[model samples]
Target: MPDGPNTLLDLNQRSREVFRQLVETYLATGDPVGSRTLSKAGSRTGGVTLSPASIRNVMADLEELGLLSSPHTSAGRMPTEAGLRLFVDALLQVGDLTDDERAGIESQLSGSNRTADGPLAQVSQTLSGLSHCAGLVVAPKRQARLKQLEFVPVSPGQTLAVIVFEDGSVENRIIDTPRDMPASSLTMASNYLNARLKGRNFDEAQRRVQQEIDARRAELDELTTRVVEAGLAVWSGTDAVSGSAGRSLIVRGRANLLEDVQAQEDLERVRRLFNDLETKEELLQLLTLAEEAEGVRIFIGSETKLFSLSGSSVIVSPYTNAENQIVGVLGVVGPTRLNYARVIPIVDYTARLVTQLVR
Candidate 1:
């Protein structure tokens, strides 16, 4: 046994080769790889002649170093979370997506008559089908610059605030109005905001409006000022109907998590995972971390708090806008035994396709 930094660099060439082969086999079959299996699978180890006894000695050393684990009295061994992390970080060789896959992804996302919902829905489904795992995407928040603002009377003390964006998107919010406020006050506030806030984002418009009010440049009665403030606040706050800072979270293929359940413990873990997905807050926070990542980010078992109990892994990559600003994140969630060599590139390509389509 060779030891130094406890990484792949620390292992002797033969030991590294054996460990790599064992992890690959376990990932493929989701079963432990015994020393005898390694001996028989000589081709996987570069035709190295390793007897079962010799393989067993290496497996024991790996287990002692916390890289492998044994279940019950089985002679085989499976990679631990740490082992999977090490392999993903160093030993794995990523594969490219096939031409058919690239075409499929491009066709789905790059339709001529595409609506926001259509591309996003198809992307999630495509990812789920290709990866055989649950697909997850943190949809970009639809924030548009102010094009027009209108206040219409709804009832005695309620006014409807209709916001039209530069992109032609429209949203309506009901705001409480002072009963004594005159109908002309609505027009006054609407005209005032439209002149100053056009083509400005929500934050920028709000700041400019407040600055004007503080400087006392615009002459207005207290009632009209309150009406203008209320109108701006509605759009500034999150769209309550959609939730999550106006961003949508898409999760598909959750049933895939249960397809391979072989025990009560496995079923319980799947149930927990389903519950975790339902709580979108945690998943949103997890995906937000990918915004700062340059490319793909892998979170193995126990590394992410939300999946610690479920022992799941997540692979995420951020998709950017034309300006290279990250607008959203897309990824896959599955068991630790997922084929990272294949799935990693699939995610990478999907993210790039999404970015292009978004632009």
Candidate 2:
């Protein structure tokens, strides 16, 4: 075995071919691959013709190079994380998804509008179910600039804050008015804010209103300002319902993680990974890797801390809107020994399909 990080670079042609073939087989099946198995596999050209003893010597060399690990009982070897990365970057040959797979994806993605629930969530769930892996999606921000506001009295002290965006999407939040504040006062506050902010962005309008309040320039009582601030706070905080640019995450197939054979060691780690996926913020941070990546991004074991504990892998791709702007991310999470050659291209194609559908 070579002494350093450049070990793979120093390997002879035959040894390199043998290592690559072993890594490929191990990736396809999460099990140790023996030399005899390689010899009898018939997939390789003429590289596997060596005797079993000769192949074992090569396997020992690969194990020393940090590319393969030999189990105590089995006379076979499996690729390590470093080995998998090398194979993924230099040795793996990714193939295109078949037409049947594409049609199945299309059929699953089409279920979004057929139900009352959000389409993006449906897409995420469907992707997870089809892949037999965890699926995640950053939901699209559908809210546009706020265009109009209306307040209607639903009860004595409660009014519905109807917010209309430039995109024609509308949302309402029930706000509690001051017990002594009259309906007329609420209308005055609504009108004042609309006149100053009808054509402006929500965040910008919020900042301007805050500045005005700070300067004591707007002619209004403290109570009216309080009511306006309360209404805006509710709207801003619930961006999902209001269609603002706040982040959203949906994850499915967490149960698939438990099926991993290696996860039997300290299952708590996998539990943390699953729990982290539930929160929108933490999940967004994980998906943020896809934002900076070009096309598709693959995180194979220990490449990211969020997934390191689970000893899992993630493949993500960004999906864009009609304007060619990246609107969200979609991807799958599975065991590290997953079929990267197959899944990588599948994920890349799924990202493109999602972009087309959203457009």
Candidate 3:
């Protein structure tokens, strides 16, 4: 504990016990803790044999090390963000979830044949209930494989581009048509796409079609080129091998912010957290690091730039398809002082659930 912000550590048994007691009491009551109160909590276990005076000295040392902060003119101390991070990562010992907790999560994630939104919404609600904090879930963009492309004339100057995916997913886009174009033009483009690019993804179709159009420009009319270009532009914006979907987000449990226990000291940070959730692109970028992770990954405050503004923490793990190709991610976002021991396993289990669903 020499200088500027370092993670909390207590090597000796006595110091460690004192530190643990402080964090446990603070978490339980959400209050600034005095040394005498911690001494009583320690005495119940007969683990820490320090007197109040001695505990105060230890707390002073911890505060000096940037582990605990003392309120002005108050004989009480609380853990800083760094201290809470260290407690969650190394010190806290979370027991197995109770049967009810297991059931709550399982009931939502298992044996359900609903849309992707169903399980995700359930996850957000459950997390909020369990943690008494706001919950968040970013929806995974749906990417359906291509089956057929059909163009139908919707109006004199508008045509409907209907793309049917192999998975029975359908997407439609409207494109402007050149005046005096024949109905046969629609038939020609649709037949051409089905003959050449059926069973391929939109990107593959785009590349092959572009090559064909370029090589056979002399053989094609203006209407065909416009139809192909419109189709390509529409598919390019999807969450496939083209541009980004910019990510989807879900947040639950905002009412947990009204928990009456924690003092109304830094409520603004929590407010900022909610506001940040509204702009999910930033959160998705923050969690995207998990796509490259082997297992669950934790990003504490200041660890990544995406979450720097609010000093929040994220626990993320990627979900994969049957082929082991990563498809999406599942995670939680909360204050830096979150119960990592509990939430870490929750996120891990949810990631597995997502994988099972996609597979």
Candidate 4:
């Protein structure tokens, strides 16, 4: 495939119209467009004022330029992924979403909950229903502020650290302590953390507490320090400590991909896509990349290895919190032929709606 730089300006007016006609027809029918079909087509269907022989020449030129390809089964041509990208970047006409559509989106997302990972399941499910694609969401990573931490002797050599957060959620971690250890050490560890961990999340508390401990500023015995360290370490990967949340990946409506399946190859592609979606860790990692992007991002087939085998596409946009801070991302995953002009605004509008609701 030719990968050198190319743009719409390179094509003459006839070539551009033929390319546009071919792509729009193929996208509408999920079938190849034949030169004869374009020649006899009516104006509404983007009929070109050219003979079949002339249209075939244009098709050959587009194929040579790597903008179109023909399936072995037929002599018709269809746009390649590169061609689709060019069309989206240049020719696609995206109109504003209707007032009813915006109101409907707002109606669906209006809820009272407020947090980083708030109401994601509903949001994704709504996208799937509307777009007829597998809806995906990446919940914001958030750590609740630490409220109180307590140590209680559980067994001969085990102790439980009862962690409480400002959000009223409690988690217990059991650690090993000396059988004859003084109860004063547990009390001392509790006093140290409760005083230090109340207002801060585990990450902030770790930094401050460890700095003080390193500087010998904390008035704690060695055993008590070990107890404190153990509690902190146990919470390392939890939402209380990690930068990403534990429940961050949400995928809905995998079967919606089958709605457009026309052939056995289409079924096979959906099967592969299903497998990719099932791999939540990798998919979530891919979606998290959108968190770093400015606005809507389109990942066409072969652009990302995760969906390369399936020949799928992902259209994502990051949603923001009240302060215009990007908190998470949400979007749809579907076939490359998904109506880009239509769905781009949907994803963008949904992201903005989520931003308003999240705040």
lDDT of 4 by residue, 148-267 (tens): 999999887789999988989888878878787789999999998899898898778888989999999999989999888878877754433333434367888988999988899999
Model 2, runs deviating above 4 Å: 1-8, 42-47, 71-75, 114-117, 149-162, 166-192, 196-245, 259-263, 266-270
Error of 1 at 254 (Å): 1.6
What is the C-alpha lDDT profile of model 1 across 42-145, one tens digit per residue? 85645546989998998888887778889889889999888888888889999888899789777766763476566777777778888999999888866678
Model 1 segments more than 4 A misplaced = 1-6, 43-48, 150-161, 173-196, 209-245
Report the C-alpha displacement of residue 97, candidate 1, in angstroms.
1.6
- How far off is model 1, as Cα RMSD? 3.9
Candidate 3, residues 22-132: lDDT per residue as tens digits?
887787666789988977876888756789999999888888877888878889998876677778767878566777867777887675447647777776676677766
lDDT by residue (23-55, candidate 2, tens digit) is 877776777999888887734566567777788
Candidate 2 TM-score to native: 0.77
TM-score of each prediction: 0.83, 0.77, 0.77, 0.82
lDDT of each: 0.84, 0.76, 0.72, 0.84
Worst 10 residues of 2 by lDDT: 237-246
Scored by Cα lDDT, where does model 4 land?
0.84
In terms of lDDT, model 2 sits at 0.76
Which of the predicted structures, 1 or 3, would earn the higher lDDT when compared with the native?
A: 1
What's model 3's overall lDDT? 0.72
**TM-score, cand. 3 vs. native:** 0.77
